[model samples]
Target chain A: MKNTILIMGHKSPDTDSICAAIAYAELKKTLGFDAKPVRLGKLNRETKYILGYFKIEEPELVTKIIEPQSEDMKQDIILVDHNEKTQTIDEADNANIIEVIDHHRIVFNTANPLYYRAEPVGSTSTIVAKIYKENGITPTKEMAGLMLSAILSDTVIFKSPTCTEEDINIAKELEKIAEVSIETYGKDMIIAGASIEGEDLADVVKTDIKLFEFGTKRLLVSQVTTAGVNKLLETKNQIIEVLEKIMKEENVDGVVLMLTDIVLEGSELLSVGKYASLIGVGFNAKVGADSVFLPGVLSRKKQIIPKLTEILI
Target chain B: MKNTILIMGHKSPDTDSICAAIAYAELKKTLGFDAKPVRLGKLNRETKYILGYFKIEEPELVTKIIEPQSEDMKQDIILVDHNEKTQTIDEADNANIIEVIDHHRIVFNTANPLYYRAEPVGSTSTIVAKIYKENGITPTKEMAGLMLSAILSDTVIFKSPTCTEEDINIAKELEKIAEVSIETYGKDMIIAGASIEGEDLADVVKTDIKLFEFGTKRLLVSQVTTAGVNKLLETKNQIIEVLEKIMKEENVDGVVLMLTDIVLEGSELLSVGKYASLIGVGFNAKVGADSVFLPGVLSRKKQIIPKLTEILI
Candidate 1:
């Protein structure tokens, strides 16, 4: 139908990105709106595990929101988790973004007014769960499970600096509804997501990346969480090669990858491309040839992006 | 204190703009925040009448949100009713927009995530009233009166095309708390605002204007609601001269004034400058030198701006 609205997150879907889209789409459907959840990219390991555990179908993948053949048709969308043009699906500039439910820095604008709800929280799922509670609609067990997983994943099991009291409260409520133990389930999910043993180095470097614009420079920042940072560093040269290719292809001034060890609560930062050394200058850490270990740096949004933005802008 | 947050509306503030800012600031204060309401420009007659009738003090007027001497000090702001940088106070770009509660097209962006709530409602007062209800805080009689008056003024007593069912419901609840009959009070406020008798033509033309950019062309759209459109038309040449001066001074491609008649429920469109004839082409009406009467056209946001944007872009 022409009125059918697509709900999606950003390209390179993570747990919160995919789960928030599905949960919000379900909320919209209960409110008598024709909505479908879609994903911009393949699901990551943790998101795949959660969806499989919950017996929820993976959202259909879509590269372009508006097709040329459907240019005259109304392609209404509701963005969740992310709002930047650089991070969304292709041809999003041509689609009608009717609503945005996000918890990230806003680099978005629209010509007409619509429903926009943003909060400085750990995850978009926190806001979505809050909305469901506000509307007096309890989520189904499957939806609750997905949302709980997303909160845990995005907040790094409540260890992230971005986590808030609201996120913890909502996660507790969702844990009860989903009949899951937060400690055991969250640990399992995080461990599952952190395993990159069989994955290609290029895909590992490409996944969970975001493009940021600072003044005149474009930078691509990527993060991969693991249980052992040294295991990933064993392939440091290969990762740097992949980063350099991505920087050239994306036409960004710099590329950075954070090899985060969840248990260690730190990240081994790898930098490549034009403005790589500025990362060390921004963080006040000595720049190694390619990498430096920053202790207690878990959040890309809070611990990394803002610092880089300050130095770059 | 450095933590004081200023809440304000756009330049040439209207009833909804001023009242919504005041009500939201009060809500923030009740929630234990250091908040103060401010206005970007002198209040229009309708807003001044509502505040005076309710015995509420007018908000402080501020031209620039940040002082150059206090550049290192935190200047946090919350915008209400409007979000476009072109319509907000001077130097808003330098201020930290911590929150935005708006009911207009979004042309706003931020580097950091914050509380942003927008809805496609008739007035910002409608959203503000809903928030008060959600938070379990009852507005005082004075605040309720101001909010009710704003809904009536912005919705043209629920006659404008932009009026929504939520506006009417919220207005009724606010009217009861305000202890005022909606019909009589709304009529008095509207009539008071519509009277342009003894006012300078230039001042009337300059009030309630918004700058819109479409495909590199900037258009200044001004609106004035009156009971007697014919009386205002008597000074059409003088109004055109003022529009011409504003067009040149603002360096805009075009300037348009919509002389709306609240009782008649129509607007007489006047155009000046380079893109003048496009207004007639956009509305499919005959362009008579400077003016064209469009019956059943009362909303600049709903009817006029979208049509002009379609033609211009």
Candidate 2:
């Protein structure tokens, strides 16, 4: 008998990772596989709201999937999340993983026996969208909503440079399936997620942060979204100061802070040290004494990465 | 004098295109422009069904919008149907179409001055989705339902290759707003649109037939969807025979008949010509006497064109 497999993604389980696991499980069922949708962490308010809109119960949180990606057939586990707790294949108790898929830069290591796929794309939801498209599986609105939500969350409402035409197309398909106006949902979700009243300045800068290595110099990119750009503008200096300390602590070459105005279709870019001029020149932005201002840079992923990479490297 | 602008695509006024036009018009109003959404052709039963489901009336048919995108102006107009009858654009218009935006590959050169945009992505609705995204606009559930309906109709429930990530994302968003399941709604809509019993075989195929030109070859790709592929499968040869005649009469390089089985997640690719093998080879597909079984193939735009172009060129 095949054992039950709990499919999941990173902690804070954004829409794409959550929905991909669910849709894939549904597809696995169609293809005669035993799988279940699992989340590694608690759902955020926006995710909860979208799920409630679709009347879908929140998927159970599975701390870890036993056998993750590869073929040791050994009961090794791969840990994921900011806190990074350990989990192993023996704990998942599944005979085989069948498949492990994600869009993040592949941080986990696992020992498993089965199929797995990973690619560097805008969102994991795009990968799942392709799977459903290639399988001829018509997604339910709940799944579509989840996928759309994931894309919005990951792409930061297409602000992230991670978004592609494929991501946009998948978002479009999911929009019809989920039956929500993405722009409306995206704006609302961004607004809901952007409550920065009492959060730590460091926490705000670290919220959905990613690190990149360019040559000998390391780069830290942090993205924060608000309903409007005013909040970030208000806390601009504090954020820059916090990032400076974190950079020193992390021993990073350069650090950048991006405050996305979800409703305003642009972002304010703050940079420290040697990277400021590079980013400023590449983005054709307004250069200040300590930072650069991007007039139309709402999405950190889409707007910053390409230009920064061009200049940094 | 205020000018009248009519917005439409093909015959059916779907959710994205329809709602986008409405939302854009609303945005235009905020920006000091007058616009209205207009349907060029009559809506099928599915459009009517979804509209009834959402308790909204169908938009008036504009027959054609005389305005063009180049002028960057808005207008009021009269409505007309396929029968060439007319009404005041205000009295007959379904939604306000200030600018014409589409994603279908078919380029237009109309009698009216048209402000048109067509992107080679999945659905015209996706373009509308972007308008709302660009303007920070929010749509009501009823409006979201209209956009989702358009997307479902145009994308063939996300099976249409024309579907993009944006389309899927929007579909998901719309699903929540419309309070309907994407899969269930898709099944119902496909069934509603799947009436081959009374349709003239040739006429059915002729209606909404898409033409593609590659090198010296012009391929005629006709799509007809049915709930069950089996019944259509029974009439396949007959449909093929009619398609062959149509292809010959139209003087095209080749003919491909796509009998889309929406629920089944596959397409029966029937081609009649020396070029049939060209498509088979391009897609790495299995070929019969005059056909190929395209597994996991859905959209006519996404799947067929890329494959066909590679082989023919």
Candidate 3:
């Protein structure tokens, strides 16, 4: 009732998503607006490293939300993801998403009149950087450094397909303010987050889950991740098939799964699509002898969405 | 000689610049290559936020390299910016650049031999996300989230003038691997960075500097900072006159400076141009107004470059 705004992001909160949500909320507050940051899934090891870097505490993990999409979302409940990208929602001058921030390809079925922008950079934190710019705001050195670190972690030092030059520039600027070396710091951060000693696999997946809706054909895009590479590939198909059955029973459109080989720099995209070819062609997957093989596919957001949009559209 | 790579960023180092250097170096090392990230200019607060987010230290700041820009850059010199989009140096197979990454609008520059990609996102860290997606590539969750955070920071949570939808989506996806909350965490990062106490006003300007080249002329663009809006506006004209003299004394074609009031969400763009009218049109500044009154202009890379380019071209 206090003009509450839900700051949400994608599932599986990363540094970009987490930092964007937090920065955006702060910006709104500075602009005299009430906003709360929410996450769709749990935090990961790398995100923890970023949080630790800034000496900020991480948010709690959230498994379920009231709705799948933010569009036409019930005023009673707001759906927020870790990536902080809003998909759909009705626009209202007041209390209707005043802004939606993200760094992924745009995909929303909403009739909301709101301020929205999505860039081609590696992370949503890049978008947050602009928010500070928009408000004539400059982040504290520590804050800037943390956001810069988030960009480096997601963009892979700008080597991945998803990176852009702006990301690199912004990171550099923030680095100066933060007074730290990103290359050396990034290595230390990665080493810090490498431990997956004791955790529930399902819990990890649920922590960063996203609910997708295509014309009421609901689907759950659950990104399951493991620390090792070969282990994920070995049982990739089995995991997909099982997830597919689970989705079908739940009256969902399909289950699109990712078997990520983090070390090899590729992903095994498995889907139970009623129209597999359509989805496959959309994703630019190899017309495999059996299952679809996305060579050099590292990101579901960058690789799969483009193809999926083509198919879905 | 030992395959050393010098990583360079745009004139002003932002979150993407800082993170790309670190993440890319890590990826190269994983691929069994020698790489080092370098900052073209001094870093800023946002970059510090990102580094802190990932718990990674910052890279050494390099104001300039004695080496010149060339197609025959050695492996020791990696010229990386945060604005290369569409095509990248990776297209060339013969050049020793070996790899390139960025997050700004695409450029028309010729490609060099290297592995590269330019996304439409706002930060270079988005590219780092793909590196994590590689097979057998296992960056720490903190590293992954660090990249994601950097993207959001650079893109202003996908709200900047240069943001795209793809950037938002990729950031969302990276959240899973990074395990960060976009809203709260990002807010913390920025807040930490916004506190600029004990900062040298001159130091802020000297770092993260960009150069503008016009027809038969050149301009050095830099930003000076103040704690509040009062000091910034008070010293606007004095700063401009001083910069103009310095520009002439240095024998440079032009000098444009920004008196950024981080708290007020505005900037006073000051410049001394031979073609004052052209510069005015380029910056949308008024005649005799002294400095351009820009509401919410924080990023020289994102806010100023494109507009200036339009006027220059």
Candidate 4:
């Protein structure tokens, strides 16, 4: 019998991370592999809405990729959406990553040769959909819907600079299969995902947090999309306190939270911790107290991370 | 105008490394990219014989992937065959690695998402050949011959344990295109590659060297194929001296030389420096002075690196 393989995404599960893991796991299962989809953390509002709308269940929550006591079993895992150690599940270093299907910058290595397929696309779902097509397996309607929602969520309805032509084309094919109007369903999903009202400031700040190492320094970058950035900024001091607390707790050198306004196609950037001033230097903007508004900064992967890496490193 | 993209393999250019780069560059050029294949070092006798057989010129030798004075140029590179920092050319850290097509264990990272396609196969030429087929482009006779020889050379005419069904199938297709009998051509290539009659001890030992870092300790592993291990063993002391000199000059923790006998399907292992005994410990074999012969050990990637990593790390 083949060993059971777990398919997982990065922590603080976003729509792309959660949905791509499920979709790829489904594809793997169809191909006769004993694969199961898993999530590293609780699904955010966006992912929950997407799964609910498509009548799909959330993946099994796994705190760690490998159980410490089960070392003899040698758990095999396939990573999706993200491939960075800082963003992956706990004890991922111990897991035997047999394959990776990602649409993110790679900071991964392996002791043995394995299957790795990464592309500079908007979403991991786009790549998964292409894989399904390559394998001559059409995704079920529910699966197609989940993957389409993930693409729309990650690409911000094709507004993100990270969105590629392949993503748009794959989304169109998926939309046809799911029998949904792309514009209507995409807008509804985006608007549903953008609602963060009545949520705790700490939860909002930590929802999509990712840690990045620049030279010897570590920086934590968090992002949350909202229709109303100005409304969220009303509690700026509380957010700063939460960010600072997270920095100290995580022992990171700096913390940055991007309160992105999807409609405005920009972000209200907030900074805290030791290297906060470097953000201003990186983006060539003024950091007033703790916040700055940057126009046309939609993607953390394409826009923010590259700029931060350049200045910080 | 499109920017010139350099397609390169790892240093100490082997048959698979050299041929895969040329084949991939040819594929990219056909797809309308300005790509050029380059080598990091002089070709080995096996590689030289393969290129001569195919009537293909050697790739331009490049000392560095990116020149220090041309930092603004941002040289775009597509790595083939290997993807480790220690094995890559100098200044590769500065080059914009846009794509990678390799068949080795990955220890690569990039700040931006790029096209990375890796598989666990015997040779990179097998993957490149598949790409050619995927694009609906049949390789020319010379290209087919080159790729076929590469697969034969790396797989030791399908004798290495690393050889896969895909490699065999791809070689069959390439053999027909190249109009060469697989068994005849493959044996000829392997036999031609095995002759190290009058080569210097230093040249023989350093011909196919690879550097690996295990937790802070760096180890240099080199391999040379021959049909006659006894012939090479006559000068074992001189080879040990050369390995010792390499350890000191390169500041490595250890140096290992595997005199692989393709016909016998085994390697006569030699070691020097601080972690030399660990090699014997890794293989569960007794070390006598500086040599140990392990039966049925062929692929370094499959047999050697993993064992070394397990014990060393």
Error of 2 at A194 (Å): 2.9
Clashes of each: 0, 82, 223, 0
lDDT of 4: 0.87
Locate the minimum summed-lDDT window of 10 residues in model 3 chain A: A76-85
lDDT, candidate 2, at A304: 78
Off by over 4 Å in 3: A1-313, B1-13, B28-46, B60-79, B82-95, B104-113, B134-138, B175-181, B184-200, B213-218, B223-231, B252-254, B259-266, B273-288, B296-313
Write down the worst ten-residue block by lDDT for model 4 chain B. B65-74
Question: lDDT tens string, model 1, A186-249?
Answer: 9888888989878888788778787888899888899888878887788778888899998888
Task: For candidate 2, give the lDDT of residue A139.
Answer: 80
Q: Candidate 4 on A178-208: residue-level lDDT in tens?
A: 9898888887787788787777778878877
Model 2 residue B123 lDDT score: 58
Question: For candidate 1, what is the lDDT?
Answer: 0.88
Worst 10 residues of 1 chain B by lDDT: B65-74
Runs of candidate 1 with Cα error greater than 4 angstroms are: A68-72, A209-221, A228-257, A268-294, A304-313, B68-72, B210-221, B228-257, B268-294, B305-313
Best by TM-score: 1
Best by lDDT: 1
